[model samples]
Target: MKHTIFYILFLATLSICNAQSELVKIEADTTNIRIGEQFEIKISVGETENVIIPKLSKLNGLEVIDSLKTDTLKNTISKKYILTGFDSGAFYVPKQQIFIKNQVYETDSLLINVATVKIDTTKVKKFPIKGIKGEPYQFDDYKNIVLIALLLISIVLTTLYFALKRSKDDQVKTFVPKLAPYQEALRNLKLLDAKLLWQNNKIKPYYSELTTIVRNYIERELHVPALEQTTNQIIESLFDFSDAKVIETERDTIKKLKRLFEQADLVKFAKAKPLAEDITSDRKIAEYIINNMQPILEEENSEVSYSTPVVIVQKPVIEKPNTLAKVVLILVTAAVILILSIGLGKVISMSKTSKNQMENVQ
Candidate 1:
């Protein structure tokens, strides 16, 4: 009795289900999708009411790019799902199962063919930036380092050169002597004292000494050449010297030396036969020039002056004169001797004179 009851319940449930649902359909326009191609899908109900068409909750291969809804004859909503996909291979639309009153319906995937595109090399895509296009090594980097090194070396060398130059400059400037003129002229004159020009009978040398004394005086004092000028020229040039603070006597002595120079030149070149007195005058003139220039020389050479050598002349000594008085005195002595020797005069005088003649005159 229980089994018969179970069979009746099952048959009644099957008859009710058959009456409620005639069919559930699901379909699509395409199944294959290119990278960017789109396609559509549809789900429909026939002879169905008071029932829900299950939502397509999942899909594969064919992406549901968009979905749409429509009201149909049975007051049912049909879903039109449009899809687009971007993959190379034949992708699939997942089987979408629909549930109506807890019953299941599934959709079939229709294929949409998508062709592989031909690449155009002529229209090749360009990268915004190309990577470094050069040799494997970077020369500029090393070059910059080398240039910097050279610059440093040059700077160091230039600094060293200037420093060395400055050091040498200081040495020379500080070490150089600042000698005064007078002392130098005096020292130079002393040098000439040792080489006596007159003692050697060297006439040219004597003139040189005279000239040198005057020249050195001028050089150390007024800084001019007394030796080089003629008397008239010197006299004319004296105005220039006098313009300086040199004493009047110094000028007069310079003029005297100028005259002496003329005399010497005449004696040397013009063969002027100068008397002893004229020569003596020359020496006196040279002495005067020396004395006159002494103050300037001393002033110039508070230290020593920077000038050439000085020349010195010394006059020869003279014998004393046998004057008339001496001659007379000798005559009286001779007369007295003659009287005393009159007795032995011939004998003594003849003997003495003969002996003196033979020994000294011979």
Candidate 2:
């Protein structure tokens, strides 16, 4: 029993000098302490990587209200331990353990006292709160100039892109839009007439104009390239577009155009003269070409509706001023000449008679 007591006392004394683990330090802001005084206690471990903070036990006569820590970095992880108490008394903070690697270390706890600091109620002082002032600026003229230049360049580039796009759009608008089917056909007919090509013995041009008018109409209204198609191809394409019964009536108009074109080709290329009746037939063919599609022009493209202009000019067979006017003017002029000669002869014969009678009587 005596030996055992001695061994325990030696261990206790060793504990007072050094705790159970590796090297660590515990410190307070002040050694003499008072109650209701709040301060910080720092705990550190030596040559270590990992540190652990166990929940601190409540000190006798001290009430801890709040505690907090700070940011930790990987190389040296430091932690701030803040402790606050409101009760006034003396207290001994127990020893703490800091963990390093896998081993444990001990730190001596600080002892502090809390004594009330008396304040005279009659005296009061105000505490001021401060904020950090903004840093002063140094002027940089070149940087300002560069920034303004970049802004101007960006605006100019953006404006140029839009302006170029608008200009191209305007160009397209300036381009002549495609004429309506009947408008094109009529315009072409007017051009054909202006040439008076028939009088020039250019039957081919006359027939060519008629055929082109018809083909141009087909191409526009039907969306077909009728200009490039043969007569047979035209008929075949029309047939394919609709069943026979519906297009059966249109076949005659198609044939009329085909015949007119063929005959014109013959006169132009083969030097054949057309029958007088064929000329009238060609006019009829033109009428038929436009008449057939007039209803369609009204039905489709309702937004910008199209129409065929009526050709109100005199027909060739009508009594043209050239054909009859010269004959009438000649007959009237010859009658006037005959009347003047007869009157002059009568006056001369009467005068001679009268002279003869007078001579005989004398």
Best by TM-score: 2
| Candidate 2, residue 282: how far the Cα is off, in Å | 0.5
Error of 1 at 90 (Å): 99
lDDT by residue (tens digit), candidate 2, 248-340: 236566666667667766876798877656765786778677767432323354566444344343323333346465565556556555665
Residue pair clashes in candidate 2:
33-113, 33-114, 34-113, 34-114, 34-115, 35-88, 35-114, 35-115
Give the residue spans of candidate 1 off by over 4 A. Answer: 1-180, 183-194, 225-231, 243-251, 273-281, 294-362
> On a 0 to 1 TM-score scale, where does candidate 2 land against the true structure?
0.32
Highest-scoring model, lDDT: 2
Expressed as tens digits, the lDDT of each residue in 1-362 for candidate 1 is 99999999999988765644346556667655557777777777653555565545544544667767665765555768787766566655556665566676555545555556678998998767444333333566357545655665566556445433323222211233434554545555566556765556556666666667666666656655556766577666666656665444555565676678777777667766666566667776665566665433354545653544344433334334347645655565565445544634554566566666655543
Residue 237 lDDT, candidate 1, scale 0-100: 64
* lDDT, model 1: 0.59
Error of 1 at 83 (Å): 99
Q: What lDDT does candidate 2 reach at residue 121?
A: 70
Give the Å shift of residue 20 in candidate 1.
Answer: 99
lDDT of each: 0.59, 0.63
